[model samples]
Target chain A: MGGADIERLIALLARLPGLGPRSARRAALALLRQPQTRMLPLAQAMEQAARTVRTCSTCGNLDTHDPCGICTDSARDRGLVCVVETVGDLWALERAGVHRGVYQVLGGTLSALSGTGPDDLNLAPLLARLEEGGVREVILALGATVEGAATAHWLQDRLAGFDVPVSRVGQGVPMGGGALDVLDDGTLAAALTARKIYS
Target chain B: MGGADIERLIALLARLPGLGPRSARRAALALLRQPQTRMLPLAQAMEQAARTVRTCSTCGNLDTHDPCGICTDSARDRGLVCVVETVGDLWALERAGVHRGVYQVLGGTLSALSGTGPDDLNLAPLLARLEEGGVREVILALGATVEGAATAHWLQDRLAGFDVPVSRVGQGVPMGGGALDVLDDGTLAAALTARKIYS
Candidate 1:
């Protein structure tokens, strides 16, 4: 229904995480409908990002700089590192403004079904960071999924030789989550087991 | 959490249909993660499409050519033209492979709430196509909505001066649709009204 260029655009857009072939066509049409305002700018932005963005050598995070802003930021506590499964997770922690520390992006978790071993993740830089030896704590901020837990256990075992302490993010009832009826079995169990005393 | 270029890419992606800020960020990260394979090609495709694709003069459909492929195709019947609300609708018809005629994209339908009137649509080109003559039937293949019906009525009235016959696509129970119990009231009524006689 469109030229090869438009078809190619749609096909490439379909490769994105959330977009499929149909929505990619819709997105392409929406872009074509407003070339000056949407298409050109998006093209320019993609081109710019593609040209400049690179993975950080120090922490496996993505940024234009080699060390990344987080790695170079003196104000943030480099001694307190948060290990996450992906760059998206790192962004989530940053967005919440809950972590005033540096981050290590593992790219992905160790999944047995997917044949993802410890070697598949960005573990070398993490070990290098630990070997440098000023880090007080390494917080595993991975997901609550099975693979996340497996990855955390693997990392904990690997980091046992180091002087730094290893800890996983607490699992319990979410801060703003609904009552017990809505809570899943595992979450309710964790919440009960981790119950704290009143002041 | 990222460089300026990455931020710009995410912001631009968020402007697309069916994508919000969070999904856009995820998309950006996906693109950034595979710059060589995904991001560069997508950017190139968008740039090429932006530079080449334009609205067809004969129809309102978008293509690299002036008159579009459908309008110029010798195999198709020029005497039969399908008037649709958008290029997306034209694509839908083409995907169905049920139409052997050319198309006239109206760009959009008339809407009172959105203040979209006849002047806002691509009616002039359609009239010009009719004035040039040889069109036997002008099929209204618009949506089954209030605005679509209103636009069809408006177009029918405007085309009263033309010699060509005007007809609308049939309204009935959809092909491969679910049981009658699941049909909405309007659809059920329409189906009943447009019921076919048994052979």
Candidate 2:
């Protein structure tokens, strides 16, 4: 009756990304107050997610099935593939709606300082997919960071002997973001270099 | 294969306090990534909490029992009752570790604008508790807001005819709260009025 259950719930919630101890406690109390409306449903949903969610066999993307929706879909462009650093990056690209191709998750970029290498990532899977033919282009949609560059370079060298063209998604001024006054020097330079003529 | 289970879980989790859509998605992905370590236990705990936790009959406190642990505990000072506006307030007092007594939850304070009166609150249980026996004091630990003041005043008027003394918890500069420059005028005045001699 001292609410040990609530305390345990709070402790568990504290491990979530955006919540601290105080916010966890608040969330716990909120959940407890609306147990029927919120707590039970959330609990059930989480249980369902735990039971069903798994990594895609082909792309390393998290899904309920091995091939994943994107990898198995016939409507998507089989000739094009977008390579991303993480699942979050893949989701971001999906939300942007500019790319209609499938994705190959790198798991993470090569970071020499962190002792991460090509073998530690999903390079084998990408190479395997490319080797099967029909994919004419591989777009590197990785970040502009040092590790991202190193990984992209390694991938470029790996696919150099292959006939398929490997290119990077261009970096420039973001949509509705960073005006002239607010844009940093590096971003400004990149924007200028990658500037496209308005069609 | 699109992990609809995980997405649904994220949608449900986003409804919780302190978590938005973005963080909910991140949390869902994180939980999926470590099902055994995090997700399963949290789901089980929420299920447990939903099953067992209930509002105490003796005091409006929520706990696993009819009479909350605080209300039933003989170790606590039964003669002193701390009246609070909400369960969150009760938890806050518990966290503060200053109160050595049980609590009576008002559910909410009296609000003229919202048309909440004494009858709309949990005053019946409190009155019944007061009439039954050895309670020597009732402390109103409600906030210093308008509704709080009105509720306190109403309680004071009702308890005037009773044998037990009814008091309000003093307001001052909170512990580890407010620099002189940052303190609002009302708080500054309250702090000044409730000033204590330095030990």
How far does residue A98 in candidate 2 sit from its true spot (Å)? 1.8
Off by over 4 Å in 1: A179-184
Provide interface RMSD per model, one decimal: 0.8, 1.6
Candidate 1 per-residue C-alpha lDDT over B60-171 given as tens digits, one digit per residue, 9 for 90 to 100 = 9999998898888999998898999999999999989999999999899999999998899987877877898888999999999999999999989999899789999999
**Model 2 over residues A1-199: C-alpha lDDT tens digits?**
3478877888999999888998888898899999999999999998888888888878778888888988888999978989999887888788778888888888899997888887899877778878888888999988988888889999999889778999998887878894687887877888899988999
lDDT of 2 at B81: 91
Q: Score the docking of each candidate (DockQ).
A: 0.80, 0.67
Residue pairs with backbone atoms closer than 3 Å in model 2 (clashes): none
lDDT value, residue A190 of candidate 2: 88
Residue runs of model 2 more than 4 Å from their true location after superposition: A112-115, A179-189, A192-199, B1-3, B112-115, B195-199
Prediction 1 global C-alpha lDDT: 0.90
